[model samples]
Target chain A: MNPAPSSSATDAAPVLQAAGLRKSFLSGEGSIEVLRGVDLSVMAGESVSVRGESGCGKSTLLNLLSGLDTPDAGTLTWAGHPPRGDRRAAFLGMVFQSFYLIPELNALDNVLMAARMLKPPGAAERARAADLLARVGLAPRATHLSTQLSGGERQRVAVARALMNSPQLLLADEPTGNLDERTGDAVIELLLELCRETRTALVLVTHNAVHAGKTSRHLSLHNGVFQ
Target chain B: MPWYLYLALKQLFPAGRKFPFFTAISVLGVALGVMVLVVSTSVMGGFGREIRRWTVDTTGDVQVRADGGINRPADFLAQLTKVPGVVAATPFAEGVVMLEHNLKPSYPAVRGIDVERVEAVTPLSKYIYFGKLDDLDDDSVILSSQLAAAIGARVGDKVEVYSPLLIEALKSDEAYLGRELRVCGIFEIGHQALDSSLVFVTLRTMQDLYGRRGSADGFDVKITPGLDPDEAAARINAALPPALHGHARSWMEINHDLIFILQLEQNMIFFLLTFIIIVAAFSVTSSLLISVVRKTREIGLLGALGGQPRQVAACFCFQGLVIGMAGTVTGLALGATVLTFRDNIVAAFTRLTQSEAAIERFYQFKQLPAHYSASYITAIIVCTITVCTLAGLLPAWRAARLKPVEALRSE
Candidate 1:
């Protein structure tokens, strides 16, 4: 079940929520129904995992939650209100299975890119980005090109990039999928560590159940519903 | 602002990335268009300046004559001078008589002028290339260089000058009727049409030969620039008594054919070569469109990443402008260089053809002495930049209306 904030916790709403989220894809053959009805919630400083098999709607759910794609039939909300469109995606940080780091940019540049894309929060954005990169233990390697980094190194940078703007919620889909077992564990630890530091809510998708156990809660996506 | 154009330009220089061949071709097309603009426009501009010089300096800005041939009015000169903006009015006593040297046959043209007044109006005085304007003594006449050479006359040589401005010569004698004229000077004037055609002498000489006294056969007027030739002519016409009408001619009314042909040629060249610029702009269009297609995912990412569609549009539009501006600037440079060396270019072509006969047959002028006018250059540059901006449209449109998820997902 989705968790709610404790009374002792500050009177803050869940950082992210999705109610009756449904998405479907259409082809010439007919249509494919991926997410029939899904609901999700994560409070601040909480980490939740969605462990699922392939062809499920885990990624599509993330797409809708992040406002990168529209939902076919449900409401998606961030903070308290429904995210109207792409601009709301700013409050949510998204990382993917492939890292999807722009290859031409250096690690630091990629991280700073997101912060810069946000309408100016004033002059301190650059300082904040550098400080954030340092917290992720990527400060020394900040200027390194994406191609020069190992697979595990790239994911750290991507994670650091996602956390650049001190986002309210961070969603990662198999961020460590391409990494070795050791690298995957290290990247997960770094993600959880950063989440605690920022008091940000986290939702991670993974195939590794053992990894899911490390989160505060975990769920299985079975038959278009989360359990 | 989208951060995408910066990304695109950065990617352009990425390691292992080969140059986009289309960019090179676009630059070349721009250069070619600019080259055509410089060369053809310069030639046309040169021709216009020459025409203005031909009209203003050679034929006089305005020419006035009387309606009837035989009636020479005594008060006409004073009346013309009284007209506002009449800079100077001069009388000419002209009629037909046979001109000949010891060798060739005699020919006749409208003949005499007040030497000083003629100089004030016509470029003939300035055209005395080898001799002096002061050389037209009372007994002396000036023949054009071509005519002088044809008759073999030089300073101190005597030849017969004859005017056939009237039909009296035909009426009087079937035999050669003429008087002596000492050749005082010869002129080339660079006006080939007039060189072999006109002969000039004092008005007193024409009055004696044409049997006209008091007022000469007709008079010519030089008008001030501020004066409308027609308006001045109207004033002179109104001032005159009903017996005579002041018929003053503006330049186009006189050399209508030459000017009409030149203007038509200049306009034809301009309209024809405008297509070249249009094609160049089309190159910008295609280049920008291709750039948009190549960077579709980038645009989508920018849109997804918080860029307004307007910023995305600016990115592609900036790319188009960059390509266009860079190309136009480079083209202007290359065009100017080509114009600077156009003569060598033509000479090289002549040498490549290897035919003295063909060289003699083809070129209008030996070297293309381009009249460098700033207005023409400005026009070419402005028009090309405008065309380049228009060429940016399709790509900018695509950039503005892009859907993020669909674009990135397709990639």
Candidate 2:
């Protein structure tokens, strides 16, 4: 794996910071810990990857970071303040392994979902959604439903949706886990190029070592702690 | 254009022809419930109105009676006719009397009315099926067809009538003073109670028999067209002489029990039919619960994208509202159509079943009746929507309470 980029003087302050994070799950008769005393910080425009074996809590850590799940004992702050209420969606975006696109909506509508969470989409938002679909090379398929799209196209549409609101931090959990090698590589390349163009920070969780090598920083999880 | 509304519409009528079957059934259930309620209430209201109209037409809209009797009916009739809505007023006397025909005795209610003014006060003249109302005289009586049948008397037959006063006189003197009257006509008003109990004669005959000269029991008043009987009665009461201790009452007051029973029956039917809608509303709850389960992951995705729990709940509620609206509109249309063609439908059914006597024996009417009111329709719509919305609450609460983590973790 490529080594993380050297610390630079011009880098901005961290957009996401989590410290002493701990999480547990109840399995049958006993409680099992998923994350333990984990600390992480991601700067603006920085790309980071977390790699681990299955059930090693990489997805758990990503969920906690994305605010989709809360830690048992930890403080997570977005831009130095606790992400309370709907402020998290304003600042952060997430991509899942399953794409999680609403089946009822078309690809363009799925892309517009983030922007429309708090309010109705205007003409400008609609135009931007169309542009994002074009950028993802699926403009012709914008009107197609999730069931009609191929796996790679669905993931690409999901990527476009995650960027709809131009969030400062993007957390992706095994986004390419359901794709073939060629389609996975292509999706990853497209995602990285868009993140770089927008100067958005990325925290990706993956099992692919080759994919992890493409990020600026690489980390591994063992025993519920990142090293 | 709210996001939740958009989500609700998308979920309810999903693309690719994936219509929610359970939701459609729920809507249909509400529609049928509303349709039945409307049709039932309308028919009941029509029946009540018809009965009231018949009562007023037969007995006059308002009746003015004195404490003992109107000792001088001319002044009373003149004053009553001068009232604002009084169209016509006539003096009438009534009593229970025993009539003997061929030595078979039958008690019937005897009424005395002025031959000329009776036509103006009541529609009795129009219901005359034999002879003429003008033929009534001191010695001639108009017998209701039912009373005539019971006494085995016919037109031109001599019937012996004994008044209560005559019976009292016979008890003291051991001699009966009775009137041998001829049946001048037979009338049938299509009301069993009135037809079986009423006999009409001239005002002089009742006065002479009861020993009340130059007086009558009361005055029957017909109000102006379209005037409410209660209002006319009120006006008459306000104008009455308190010394006479006279009272005026509308036909409705005379038959309050029957009217009350009709209204109560209608309300009971409405209440009972509403339960059908409530049961239908439960279907909405069940369908929404299923939707919540099927869309758990999508719900989590929405939450992660910043949809609040309240918004999630509102989404399901909106879906319920849509279903209610659809059902209510369709049901109103269906109900109106059914009511409009009620007579035809009933006739068709009767013909198909070949049960002609069933309709006549049960309803006593050739055609079914229905009355539609705007207020009633509005109430039904409001009631149905409220029920549907209430039914949506439980599932909506369950959906809102779902944890994003647990939901996303589900397949």
**Clashes by residue pair, model 2:** none
lDDT of each residue in B194-294, candidate 2, tens digit only: 77788998999998877788788888889988998899999999999899889999999988898899889988998899998899888888889998999
Worst 10-residue lDDT window, candidate 1 chain B: B357-366
Give each prediction's DockQ, rounded to 2 decimals. 0.37, 0.56
Off by over 4 Å in 2: A1-6, B16-20, B67-71, B82-87, B93-215, B223-235, B238-245, B349-366, B373-375
TM-score of chain A of 2: 0.95
What lDDT tens digits, residue by residue, belong to model 1 across residues A1-227?
A: 44343344446677777778788888788988888888877788888888878878787777777787787777767888878554543686776666767666787777777776765334586677667778777788777778888888888888887887778889888888899999999999999989988888889889988788888878778667786
- Which lDDT value does model 2 have at A91? 87
Residue range with the least summed lDDT across 10 consecutive positions in model 2 chain B? B360-369
lDDT of 2 by residue, A4-81 (tens): 333861366778888889999999999999898888888888898999899999988988887778899989999888
Model 1: per-residue lDDT, tens digit, B1-411? 346566545543343347756666776787688778777878777756665565666546666666664255446667777878878776776555567887675464545777777776665667786567677756778887777787777867898766554355568756645678788877765545556667777777767776666456566667887776667666766666676654667665666787688768766876788789888888778877877787677666665556667766766666555666667788778877888887788778878887533553343233454676687677777777777767777788887887866666656
As for candidate 1, its clashing pairs are B95-B163, B95-B164, B95-B165, B96-B163, B96-B164, B96-B165, B97-B163, B97-B164
Which regions of candidate 1 are displaced past 4 Å?
A1-11, A97-112, A119-123, A126-161, A177-192, A208-216, B1-24, B69-77, B91-111, B122-125, B138-183, B195-199, B205-221, B225-242, B253-265, B343-382
Docking class of 1: acceptable
